[model samples]
Target: MNPTEFLDGGTVTVSDETYTVYKTEHPESAAFATIQDENETTVVAEAGTVSGENVIESEPGWKRLTFEMVLPFELVGFLAAVATALADEDISIFAISAYSTDHVLVKEEDVPVATKKLEALGCAVER
Candidate 1:
């Protein structure tokens, strides 16, 4: 795929809800995203949604920005370009790739800069 074609004409939507990343011992059904391995469970859900003894740590106030395009499996460097753009601005991101598209979680305070960086890459960002 052409890099320009992959970068341009894509929509990135900022979610209205704030999320939290949690490291928990148990699964959370309400989590927006979850990953479990032999040692731990990582959960990303709405802020203040998950609690109790199972949760080992939590990082709150993250906002999700979703790439609204259905990416082809063979497409490459899409995320690398985005990550590099943001990294240049010193913005950290937690990325999640679903079957159809990709999402990135940025600290609430970094949304504006992150949006601008993504926009610079030719993505139409909706906040």
Candidate 2:
């Protein structure tokens, strides 16, 4: 999917909360995002809520860009399109896709650059 096709959502909001990734069991909180397997579970939660052992990685200072666009489940390459745009600018990102939308996380320092890249691609970005 190309960026232009998803521009109907029009606004992408950058979250201010700092999130961290934890290596643990199924997270009990709905506030965070998680990916789980037989061997491990990766939980991305607000920094303040994470505590205990097996902390895989802490993304302490990152910003999440929420794509408000209501994407069809059948749509393809949307994340790739966004990632490619950011990667071209040397902005690394961690992405999440939910039932209604897609979100991308970038280092706090790279938020501005990420925003610019997205905007240039026709995505209206809001911080």
Tens-digit lDDT string for candidate 2 (25-96): 456373468888788777877776866655555557667889988888777888888888889999988888
TM-score of 1: 0.95
Deviation in angstroms for 64 in model 2? 0.8
Candidate 1 per-residue C-alpha lDDT over 1-127 given as tens digits, one digit per residue, 9 for 90 to 100: 8655866878999999999999999989999999899999999999988976778999999999999989899888878888888999999999999997899999999999999888888889997
Best by lDDT, which number? 1
TM-scores for candidates 1 onward, in order: 0.95, 0.87
Off by over 4 Å in 1: none
Candidate 1, residue 105: how far the Cα is off, in Å: 0.4
lDDT of 2 at 24: 62
